[model samples]
Target: MGLAHVHWLLAGIDEIAAFRLVFRDDRTTDVRGTGRLVWHGRTLVWTPGGPYAHLRYTVAINRQRPPGTHFDSYATPDWIATRALHLFPEINVRFRTGVAAARARLRFRLPRGWHSATALAALPDGTYLVEEPGKRFDRPRGWLLLGRIARYRHTIAGLEVTVAVAPGSPLDVRGLFRLYGKTIPLLVGILGAPPPRLLIVSAPDPMWHGGLSGEDSFFVHGRIPIRSPDKTCSYLHELFHVWQPFHPSADGRWVSEGLAEYYSLALPYRAGRLSPQTFVRGLALFERYGRWGSDLTRTRVPAALNNSAPLVMHWLDHEIRRVTDGHRCLDDAVRSLAHEGGTLTTASFLRAINQAAGRDFTPLFRRHVYRGEPPPERAREDDAGVGH
Candidate 1:
């Protein structure tokens, strides 16, 4: 169980000289290759001695280190990082294989009492198929949990969702399920559909401050307080990613992250997850933070923390509502973007906004988003009836 072999098929290639096998700890194990193997830093560069269509290699697994460290490749007595160990090929390298898209399958040989939780669909033959469209064969994006884990399953909003928690985790699984039961339906009402399958993994790691979202899975730090405002916002933020896959651009980070932050609170408020006082407090907090800066177009982490981006989004939402006589809102613009598949850039977002509003929003975009002007102050009269 501590050793594994991998086989790869290369087609329409003149040379296999560019393939590199990445390993976390090369010193702990020896890799035997079918061809000449050279060590290039932490990777193994393999060059076939002759014209070959298939390559095979074996790795000796190291079980001493903790699982989920070192790029999430680990093998411990209780758990194993399945994807990292099975798919060791680095995608960033140039492979002259000329194969635009390649198919791959992984079969694991694990010890008894170990179970797996992954986004990959399992075939009838017990092999997991890796068939994510547009994903390179070398680098696959998904989660694979293998250990003596605790699993909770629930059908929410017509989607099969699974929650996997590591042993001895402090997370409140029941509370999370209840919260999701409330939140997922609201999200589906807004986005129109749920991901075919959703997987949530709660791992214990003091270093992981928040959560990370993948294609269909979410990873949250175990130390976060369960059902707290921060946890609720973080979970909804990642869930928003599942609904609308926003890619960060030079000037589009504000749209992606800001929208996520905005809806993380707004949707919950509309769904009754947050009280009026709490929701207004959240907006006030963002307003306070946003006063620190005005530039929303900068691609910096701190820029995302500024409240200006979300406030401007709030203004845009109000403007769209006002212009369309409450027939349209920001949700319409976001849904339009999701329908138009591709990387979401500032121009495309502006186009969506303009189409939704039925008028050009150039002046507003220039004054608020690109130029990062300070958000307009809320009048005292308006504040008097806050959250009503």
Candidate 2:
């Protein structure tokens, strides 16, 4: 096995309070140029004596754990997750270097019979490059899986998509691939293209309950039945994130998340995976849940508010269609945002809607989304089509 060398370049560090190195393992040896190391629990309080420091450490891959719902940086025997590789404190420092640009790369010492998957692009020499422009240290950008994994490959939208599952996992890999095969086309149609490569990892842990999405990859809790409606929707929701626009302001989170929820059902229905009746039933569930108490504009919208967000989106779609005389819809607005990528805010969302409909929707947004007013009642004619 090759030794893994993790490197970091530190800039503008002049004091002890400016930085600290945290590691789960305190016995980290071969440390160079990090002055006055003090061990406080699992944290290394490094008092750097220089303005710039080059830190490198050799990490050992030890015991492996079964895939679980939560994420951590520690290595497991059969599988190695990204948290295990990039979890060191030096890479995690956010206070001083939060806004600075940073780049990272990992050289894994893969044992025989082990393979790896990550969002980072792999080099010819087997090194993985992780580059972030506006360094958001707190965000978990690095996700990896190394082990005796079962990889299923498919070509969709001119992209090579690979689904990697841990060996002995209970997840139904075939079912997952089938769902992706059907759903990905619809997603690509909406977004205008596919990522060059998509990697999905399924880790089964009875303890983990939800899924998470990263840069070009995502994780699904394997405990959920593969064909279950909830699991299917959850999987689609995470997949939608890969194509969704990034919104720095928290206010526009409703737009991003609500659209994901809206399409999680709509795409399946459009793809014939869901019957019209089932799709309407799903929307009805959202409407019922949306009536529960919560405000949409709050920085942290409650889960109940999130449950109702799709209803508002549906209403917005209907309004857009009505104003445009069927020439435009919500999809156009979303596509516009996807085409013009940046920090998405409520203003940008409104602009997209106005551009698509050729009319301003500020009043409608102010009433329903911004003010947290109750969603409009379902139209009687719409219900008849849905068989309600």
Candidate 3:
């Protein structure tokens, strides 16, 4: 069967009022595209060649519905997709795909004081490779083709990448590697060893946003939010969701959001970039913002999309750690759920905790989580968000 596809055409920045997208395919004898355009951000479009000349775009695609199958969850982002795109400020787009691969060709109609470069590097496996091409800032102010090549592998997702610098302005191969080195491991740990495919594009100005759009794997818009290290962490969190292996089936905000939150802390902690105490303090801080203290066990996990619920669960995690001597906690519960094949319920969660603690968690869970009451006043002082 042929893969489903979507096309995206971005013309401007800030508010994308007339953002037009077409979902199409040529698998059948007749080639056609179908999709929708929603009023995005908060901007309007007039003349396409106005200040909107400089733009970035992305297309994301994946398998169709088959609940709990790996296909649906594959909707996450890939790192390489937007890595080079974001580094350069250029645009002009066209697309093509073949039996084994897909490609996006973007051009720089006008040089924005930079050089465009391209490179092709072989992968360790030799069969798979990567081609990274984009504009590199030049001292003399001109265009230099910058790109990299790697052996083509099973998929074009989270593969380790190396890029060639075109007589740089500031960024060099080593510097890029530094960023990649820090980025890939976290990507692998959270998403998997192989990163998902993502599309990165550079904008004339900084915007700092990333997400999945149709036909686009993962779109990272604007200049890299250098100051916001959290953005990259957040990217990994969302992009990895494509590998979730299930869909329409509730993954619980507590599971999804908590995992994202936990990983945001866990990765940095493991890297020695964050102190354990500091991490705990962060959790404590999050506890302060919680608007929930529901009896999770009795509430059936709510199945709601409220973001606050996970913060409440985070507090519960803190309580579980406190009561279970830290040896038995949400980490254990998560692992247990993952072991049980990625489907978790409040009931299953309670059972896991009780099993780990070697005791009944009913009374404890009831008093702390199921009831709307606070966890405990003693545990609430410093974490002002939680009024236990």
Candidate 4:
């Protein structure tokens, strides 16, 4: 194991003024340098006066609401589900001339009979490996489920995918598994891929009735329908969060979101779970809803625009195919954004679309994205066929 040297560490948990870190220890007794510290009003600054420092702190668990719903983070006498990112703090480290890459791993010491799982790769020795490919410093990310629970795992596409559901949560884990078996393989290729490992945590009431995506994992309310009435699948929607090539600005966020939603519909259709006619109907609904939403450029728009955004993406794909004579589509455009190598912006999105289509797409984007104009209604036959 490699130690991460740090000059300082800082962290502030949310709603912490009420539940504070009342116990902590700074183990820097043998370090060199001033070993000095400074404190300001309600704020303090400190350094171990050495290259490395270790600090341990404890916070009271402000456990959440009664079961049957969902909570972001919660605790019970029997189990706990919470984000691991909050436990790791911000640290600044220094070397003589440069920075030392920090490698982090997580090992849990639990109460007797308790077991823990994380959205991290489990090593043979039982420790979880923490890694972030583009960063010089790697910290653990994802949710942690600790306690006595039902643990089920599967190897999908050779990735260890674990599903941990609190006992008696009433989640349809079997249905979830069946869905994964049917859709995961095809979606894996469509999605670029899943992370090295995947963790899914679920519980009944006392948790949010929704889904949340973490580093390589995510949480879903046990009873939330996997496939909603409108034909959108929350399962597939959140799965897209695992692999985002570039961070998108607010203006470009629609692209990222639209793609996720697009796949939610397309993945099912492509997987044969949804028929062509039904898929077409779903797209029409989105187009109608999007017609009332704001321009795609706005950071804040009518909530209805969520439907609009995906419609925009579907049409964008349609346009890409037409312009390139079926040689390219939105997938190529999307992949180009990653290849372009920067934060996704409107300009960058346009460049990608143009590059994929081998033509200028300024007019198309100008009318729909910038001006928020709805696409011209096409004859049903025109929109009938979906590309494979």
Off by over 4 Å in 2: 1-54, 57-76, 84-105, 129-140, 225-232, 291-293, 299-302, 377-384
Q: Please write out the lDDT profile of model 3 over residues 1-388, one tens digit for every residue.
A: 1122222233322222222322232111212222222322322122233223332333232333333432221212111122232232222222222222223233433224433322233244422233332411111111112222122122233463322222211223243344445645654543434523432222211122333321123322323342233322433344445333322234243445545544554455555555545555555544454445554333433222122344445555666777777776555655555556455555666687677666777776565455644444344343333333
After superposing all C-alphas onto the true structure, candidate 4 shows an RMSD in angstroms of 7.4
Which candidate do you rate higher for lDDT, 2 or 4?
Answer: 4
List the candidates' TM-scores in order: 0.78, 0.75, 0.43, 0.80
Looking at model 2, which ten-residue stretch has the lowest summed lDDT? 61-70
Per-residue lDDT of candidate 1, residues 1-388 (tens digit): 5455656655544433456667665532445545577887777777655545566666654433344443333445666443443445554344455545546676666679878777666689987777666556534446566788887889888878887877656777787777778888877755667777777776664324566677677766666764444313667777777667556667787788778777777776777767666766766667666644355767465544436677677778878887898899888888887777578778998999999999999898888876777556562113224634
Question: lDDT of all the models against the reference?
Answer: 0.66, 0.66, 0.37, 0.67
Tell me the tens digit of each residue's lDDT in model 4 across 314-369.
77888888877888888787777755656887888888889988889899887778
Cα RMSDs of all predictions?
4.9, 6.0, 15.0, 7.4
Question: Per the 3 Å backbone cut-off, how many clashing residue pairs does candidate 1 have?
Answer: 1
Number of the top-ranking candidate, with TM-score as the measure: 4
Question: After TM-score superposition, what is the CA distance of residue 60 in candidate 4 from its true location, in Å?
Answer: 4.3
Q: Candidate 4, 71: how far from true, in Å?
A: 3.0
Worst 10 residues of 1 by lDDT: 379-388
* Shift in Å, residue 339, candidate 4: 3.6
Full candidate order by TM-score, most accurate first: 4, 1, 2, 3
Task: Mark the regions of model 1 whose C-alpha exceeds 4 Å error after superposition.
Answer: 1-29, 36-77, 80-87, 92-102, 135-140, 189-193, 230-232, 377-388
